[model samples]
Target: MRERAVQRQDRLLSLVRRRGSARVTDLADQLGVSPVTVRRDVEALTGRGLLDRVHGSVSWPRRRDRPGGGRGPDAEDLVLGLLAPSATYYFADVIRGAHEAAAPAGARLVLRICDYRPAEDPARAAGLLAAGAEGLLVAPGWRGPGDQAAYSDWIAELPVPVVLLERSVPPGGPLAGLDRVCSDHTHGVLLALRHLTGQGHAAPLLVARADSPTALAVREGYAAALRALGVRGPRPVIGSVPADRDPEGFERAVQELRSAVSSGAATAALVHNDVDAIRMVQRLAELGVRVPRDLALVAYDDEVAALADTPLTAVAPPKREVGRQAARLLLERLRERAEGAGGGGTDRGMGGGAGVVPAAGAGSVPDADPAAEPAPRRHVTLLPTLRVRASCGAGAGTGGGATG
Candidate 1:
């Protein structure tokens, strides 16, 4: 901990030890902190069994007090449980949006980082439900190759509603009844292709994640975009490169991308995810192949895409809006379930008024009264916008010329 923080904490403990208890205002006056800060310190110290909070005052932990505390089920105000593999990148904005929407909707959106599972993935939703989460907002769990279930069946067995976030639901796939909110990644591929081809770059290589749930949709969209544009050439889709946590794999992928552009296998490429695109852009820079000058590039997700050395042209999923919509969608369901339950929401004690869901969804004012027209359904497929920048060779002066 920082020295100042330790000093403040120490001062707090010392005061409690000396006086038996100290009022929050008195500690704040002595410690150069606000009463709120003193109270927060008291709370933390109490959590560690270093002190006890005694009605606006703090005292040394009593013999009756045991820290590293316990929370009964009733203490859990967790209404919606959100789980995603990584905390940063694409999901951060999603989480932010979820929180923003959940507050007005009167729901507490609890977050859990889905960590690496040794034998099997954790019961991501069940544990949340056990902790009194009313519903779940989970990015579809990563499964093995060819294990094709869009929204898993096991989630159906769980008693709560499941809303898949930022993941695809295959057409004619299972879970017709499931609620999901995702950016149309396939449409993003088409957008990138059209942008590149419109600028006279024919047969650009498409890089993608082979083992991902969204890969099939991306590949299908690439081919469809190629055919729809009537562009004729040996269209290449490279899936040998991976999108994983390993830096080595990303570096190898970068080398592979560099080789493709350097050897003239493809002058331009559209990579599905931005992390690989950033690494590839750095590698290409190292190889003295300038983006938009030697190799035109486009990334699917815009997260950190613009931060590339060349400021990559990318198709960015509206992630925050997706998150906002996901929350609204879940709340809409909760609302309907409320109506179905004779207007008293199932978890009456949970959200009170904070979880009051807006009827017209995230971006609009309600048209028909929520009671009149049907509450908005939960499934939402948000479209992506193509961000034209230096890397794709489609912005301003770069638009007319692609090195091929």
Candidate 2:
């Protein structure tokens, strides 16, 4: 119900802005709502001074007298685009977070998902820029190895501020020139490894997608945590999931887990994400291996781990928080660029797209500053929480989970 109200309000705002002024009856008819509902919404916006309410008609505040007054930037004039690699599973939550953030942060949001294909993002970003998007929030570098240079380089060259969500340049990617927000995946993996060790599983295998930037960090964290736990000898098997999510590769990933288990390569294992973890769990069941009895499992990015039959213990990333932070960061950058208030730095690293639409009132802002000190770039790392449940056998005597 709250979501419905918010959507209605957004629609109302868009309509008023488009038409300059609208009658309450027309608004109600257009919005498929009652005149009373339109009046109430108009009343709310009028209180905020966003709408000039006269009798049954509504209109946006005039220039020099809008919400931000004469000089302040207005959010209504700006459009920020978001490009995500995946539309489902893990990335879906990030998009949800960004969507929830749009109204509060004050920018109009344009969202596009490329189905995990990084090759297509440049074109999408180009299109959004041409369509008048002023800034961008993107999840890039998730394709295969050869994509880093092209993907990161393209991001480096954009004409507007870019905030990366769930991604930052790893090695061979573009060097730092943008803001980043992502989970502290290394620490997340370390936590899972420590929990596995606590459960008496010393030689747990770590299964991960080798091509993933987040997975790479997790693998590093797993090793670092192992060192912390005083296990310095040969490390556990670091099994790699292939780059493709294609049917053949998907089957191969399941087969890889089965081989690892059957060959005794893993007494206990930490899988990188819930999707593969669920697949591994289901396969283990078919192989007659009951979870925690014969094998202990810990999954990362706990999006759907709990939905599995055994309800696996998994490390849950602060996914929504990452997106929220990224949105906030992007908005701040846009504001700074518009106001020329902060020391400015033009985007570096190579390609150019479209210019930002000029600002007015609160939405009025400048291009990049030429003389001021550059604003500090931000990188927020949020930690993941482990949700303990049945798969890790959480109970006194059966204690293999960290419920405390």
Candidate 3:
């Protein structure tokens, strides 16, 4: 606790030094703390003569002999652009994580909601750049890998540094050179399958959607996990959505699950996304099928999965952490760019946003090779863990961690 408080104070000092002066309310907001906490820290710094109180604001005690007399040139005042499909849903946590990291480092986030409009992403990003976005964190609205891969060319040609958030291109594809951070849905699938199979359930069926990139990844991962685990039987993949979106499709999924269970073709199932899984459970209940009695189930995306009547076991992706790491990576990219361009006042000495290391994930470039200079292009992939619950017939902590 003491260490964290000290670190926070150091960041507080850095921000004031970089900007020359900052309001107390703005400091609290930027630090992601309360006004009282900021006031306390300010008082402590003022006692040491490191800061000067000026009305409702604070300033560095030292004076400047010339203009631009701060720590480094353009160290503060970074405008980072973020483009996501939606502000709600999963991206909300991602945006919050990015904002939390950006604010403390004196960077402002400019968000652009594209609402799955892939064709409009470039235009929106270009507009952000025109409005003085020095760096970008973009989660392109891609329905699938192919859809995102198609837009790689334009993304690569953007003048400013770009870091992909929750999105990536194929290996050796157009955007391979770009930095990206995303959840390892493949590992997420592996977690769900291994958990079900660990309890002696073989060849669990998969009911998923193909409408989003995450859904597609889960579908593909299910196939690979089955082959890897050598669990053989009638493994079928059913496509589905919420009941209201497509009643016929939803009915087909429920019927498929019912048939599989009744015929003893499968005794367990893994469903992608919480909504579909929850709805499937509800419809199956109407048919007199009880979860964990006749069919053990696990759902992907822990969001609201636990709210079901059966309290679904789920594979939880690190959504918010993906945003934090992506933002931190973009800040580093900006610093590197500034330094390479001979910006003497660059924030080279300042610790990049939040001082947190990126979590390792799939396709991640290893950092063990000290001789590798200039840092290889990163594809940081965060793994997902399985949350055990009643639906999967698991007792407390029966599921495995991400490493498992």
Candidate 4:
């Protein structure tokens, strides 16, 4: 219901912005809502200065370009475009963080949702550009390596500055030199393993999917993290699908973990995403196996981990911070371009904001040279921390640190 309300309000704002002003009755009819509801929404928007409520109508405030306008007094009106796969679930917080950062900067964030239409991404970005977007923050839905290869060329050729949000390209790819902000999944896997190992459990088995980039990262990171921790055991990783999409595949994953636990071959496990983890715990419970008793468990993504019956101790990637930093970087790039200085600087390592180190293997941050002017591109990596809970035999404790 809350999501629906947000969508409706977004539509209302877009309509008023495009039309300049709209009668309350007309807005109600166009939005498929009652006049009372439209007036209530208008009142809320007016309070925020997003709309000016006149007699029986609402207008996009004219003072938008002046001091004490809807924007900050010292800020120039900046328009940014955000293109993402979906607005709900994990991307919801990402979008919220971008908005929170953009508001104080007096920037208007325009969003484009591309669902089940990977081929339309370039076209959608063009539309955002045509709508007067000065820059773009894009999260392309690249299902595999092939998808990246197919989309990287045009994405690199976009006219405005672009920031890859929670996405990265392989080193030497067309967009490899572009600015990107992503959570270091390798560090996230390390935190999950260290926490489980500190609790006297051997290397936990991994159950993850290969359909998405983050899933692939978790699967590969699990092995690397295990080796780094110097904990050696039967390190078997299984595959899983969304519980609703492929029940049989999910059941096979659960049975694999069950076999490992029942035979005392494994004592702890990590699941890629929270939804799959929660469903696994529920199914395991029905089979007479309990979390933190029969098998200690950790889940990744931390999206809804805490809501599980036995709250899950999960690795929470710095998702919101990634969005914030990515937007800030793009804004900075735009400011530099506006100031007549080309986008180049003394290897401004990630330290300018958060403890963002350059992402290893994804791309290289050029070494600072005293003779040369400065290096322009940056690939920032944020670290994820572990949230302890009942599922991992820890009682509501924050156990992991950001530093690896």
TM agreement with the true structure for every prediction? 0.67, 0.70, 0.73, 0.75
For candidate 3, lDDT tens digit of each residue in 1-404?
Answer: 45365456767877887787899999999999988999998998677455789888998655321254323213555668898988987788999999888888878687878788888788777656643467789888888657875765677667666788887566655566577899999888888888888888878999999988888888889888887888663665888876888899889889988988988888889998898999889889899888989999999999899899999988988888998998888887766555453122322212221112235633332563333223445789999888888898754346333335
Model 2 over residues 224-340: C-alpha lDDT tens digits?
Answer: 777777865344445555434565665666666667667776667888878778877776688777787777888888888889988889988888888788877777776676665
TM-score result, candidate 2 = 0.70
Number of clashes in model 3?
2
Q: What is the RMSD of candidate 4? A: 7.8
How do the residues 1-404 of candidate 4 rate in per-residue lDDT, one tens digit apiece? 44365456767877887888899999999999999989888887677556788899888767554443223222555678898888887788888888878878888788888772568787677656644466788888776646777765777677677788887677655676678899899899999888888778878898898877788789889889999999884756888998899999999999988888899999999998999999999999988889988998999999999999999988898888988998888777666555434224422222121122355722334563434322356789999988888898873233433233
* Number of the candidate with higher lDDT, 3 or 4: 4
Report clashes for each candidate as comma-separated counts: 6, 13, 2, 0
Q: Against the unseen true structure, what C-alpha lDDT does each candidate score? A: 0.65, 0.69, 0.76, 0.77
lDDT winner, 1 or 4: 4
* lDDT for 1 (candidate 3): 40
User: What is candidate 4's CA lDDT for residue 68?
Assistant: 38
Across 353-399, the per-residue lDDT of candidate 1 in tens digits comes to: 22224555552235634453334334688888888888876465444
Q: Highest TM-score: which candidate?
A: 4
Candidate 1: list runs displaced more than 4 Å. Answer: 1-78, 116-122, 147-151, 171-174, 240-256, 263-265, 341-378, 397-404
How many Å off is the CA of 87 in candidate 3? 1.7
How does candidate 1 fare on TM-score?
A: 0.67
Ranking by lDDT: 4, 3, 2, 1
